[model samples]
Target: MLEQFGAAIQQVNLSTPVLRLFGTTLALLLFVLVSRALLSKLIRTGIQAPELRRKWLVQTRNGLILLFLLGLVLIWGQELRTLALSIVAIAVAFVVATKELILCFIGSLVKGGARSFNIGDRIQVKDFRGDVIDQNLLATTIMEVGPGKLTHQRTGRATVIPNSLFVSEPVINESFTQDYVLHVFTVPFKRDDNWQLAQQVLLDCARAQCEPYLESARKYMRRLGDRRGLEVPVVDPRVSLQVPLAGEIHLVVRFPCRQGQRSAIEQAILLDAFGSHDFSGKRKEGDEEGEEPSAVIE
Candidate 1:
């Protein structure tokens, strides 16, 4: 049986097509090698400059290798095509088995091609929001940014998200502004609460907190708009009123601040607004009974 098996293998190896491919491949490789060696020697002798000689040798070697490859491809084209056809079903099965990995690789390609986001950028995809710490073909690692979007604080945990998500989910890059960002936060108030007073106080606090970087932010935004051909909103502090439900009012304040100082600026504005007016609607000791304190900050 061993003898018969050996004979069978030898027969297959010595088949006409196999011998032809092997002979052609060997001839091409030897030709390329000899041609490269001769050209290298000729270049060294003909070119006095070391740099020019090296350049010529490299180009000659590359050209010869390319020609050798092309020759082999032409010689084995029909055989390769037949082999490919034979494996079509197997190839389909392989693709199905590794669909996710293929998608991840394609997603990486998409990310790179689009220049979607970079390391150190704060990005949000679906429910994941974080600063991209590392990235690879398979997944991206991020330092988790928040328990909620409003907090704008790191959660001290790392999340590895499959790169495949890049294909399906929209990525929001918060750090696109680099240093300064237009941060928006909401202060909710009851309809019966003095919402007008709350809105005014919040606006004042935002303007005061954002005053230092307001002009710089504006200029940066204007330049960004001109460069990107975008219609960017003004960086000035502004407040808008929203009514999400009956008897519920939301005061949305948009303010410009350093990217890293969003939470701090927000806290400062909240504290200042809180101190300026009594949000609890509780009367002070000096106030008579039935005197409402102010609009409550929910």
Candidate 2:
């Protein structure tokens, strides 16, 4: 009675769906192995050339393996289909859980495709401006730059921004030219001051400071323009006058300088211009307070 009970339980288990699938898979695999062995034997004995025999044997083995995999899929197609549906549902849930992370990854891809900025390049996006120090899939690390745009000085802070910002904001690459860039700054003066003299003083100072590399910068600009089919601007020092208010005048100066030297060059020019007697609107010794200097604007 005990032996009969055990036999009946074993028969019931074998008749279940999972056990039936397993048995079918095993039988299919056995058939594939037998087929492969018979084909290999036939190739080895029938082919006269050694190379041909080896090639046929390899081909037969590969075909049999492929057939075995196909048979497995066919035999377990229902189970595999169920498993695939479950996997897809899990994937959807996971994606919903990590939406921000996915957006960051997509942003990184966008940045790469656009070739917007790179390591050591100065860039500004939205309100953040800095030199890129490091970057990964999730965030970009930059050394903070500026109390403002005119300052062009580092704030000695590191900022890690999420890559997702790249997808929505326009990126300004200050160091796009690599080694040289056109830097602009402004000097304000009172309307009563010697505005003309100040403009000339600033222009002269700029020309003097940039004279050394003016030719190189010009050539670089020309080459870049030609390569990109752009109308390149003149690289010579220029000072434009702007009167935004009734009592003030702004001398806007634009000059070319080496990358990372904009602040220094601007400082040098300001020092030279302010230190000049004519620019300071100060009369020389023994001159009337209201009298203009003997120096004439050329």
Candidate 3:
């Protein structure tokens, strides 16, 4: 009876597919573990540059996960094939139900393909402006800068926006190709008091304050223009006079500056302008409290 029982067990083991499935699963598991260890070792010792190492590690990790999933699917594909029609129907229903989610995914793909922006890029979309700190398939994370649509100063806020905005709204790329950006501000003066002299003083102050960035920006922009087959715009200090209000003249100055240093440069320019002989003894036509124009930087 014991011999017969052992014979029955042997027959059952031979006839069942459990052993084959176990063997295949073990093999795949071993492959995944060995490949991951080898790739990690290679990333640690082979890659020297920090940026390159980071990039390699990310790509390799993602690739390994994808490869493991593919192996599993291939191994169990026969079983999955039986349910393909049901899976397709479910997928279609899910996609139809989650239309916004699908649109966001597709928008992310489009953004990636277009390379419209990258990590650390300063972008403004639909009133949200900041540096992109993180990005994923569904949303983008931004460190808030220039809140309330006021100045370009960082507001110490972090925001997450859906990637679908890339498809629906306009994106303003402030730090594209060149690191330097134009800082614009307006200084107000009474139309009667040394306005021309104030303009000269403002221009000279701008040139003196932003001189360091001019040459470097010119070279960088020249290279960018050559690469893109576009003309490089003049990147020097520009002063223009405009009459936004009736009685005051606006001295608008736009100068090349680093994004982070815009406020500092604006302060420096304002301080210098205030101390200038051109801006002293003002208020020829307007009251000191009501007519005195202040410097507004943006």
> Model 1, residue 106: what's the lDDT?
87
Q: Is candidate 2 or candidate 3 better by TM-score?
A: 3
Question: Candidate 2, residue 231: CA error in Å?
Answer: 1.2
Better structure of 1 and 3 per lDDT: 1
Model 1: weakest 10-residue lDDT segment is: 289-298
List model 2 lDDT by residue over 2-90, tens digit each: 99999999989877989888999899888988898888888878999764575566557656766887888898898878898669978
CA lDDT for candidate 2? 0.83
Clashing pairs in 2: none
153-180 per-residue lDDT for model 1 (tens digits): 9999999999999999889999887767
Among these predictions, the greatest TM-score belongs to 3
Per-candidate TM-scores read 0.66, 0.66, 0.71
Clashes counted in candidate 2 amount to 0
Q: 123, model 2: CA deviation in Å?
A: 0.3
Ranking by lDDT: 2, 1, 3
Residues 210-265, candidate 3: write the lDDT tens digits: 88768998887788889999888788887888888787888898988886788898
Give the best candidate by lDDT. Answer: 2
Candidate 2 regions off by >4 Å? Answer: 1-83, 278-298
lDDT of 1 at 31: 86
* Per-model lDDT: 0.82, 0.83, 0.78
Error of 3 at 93 (Å): 2.5
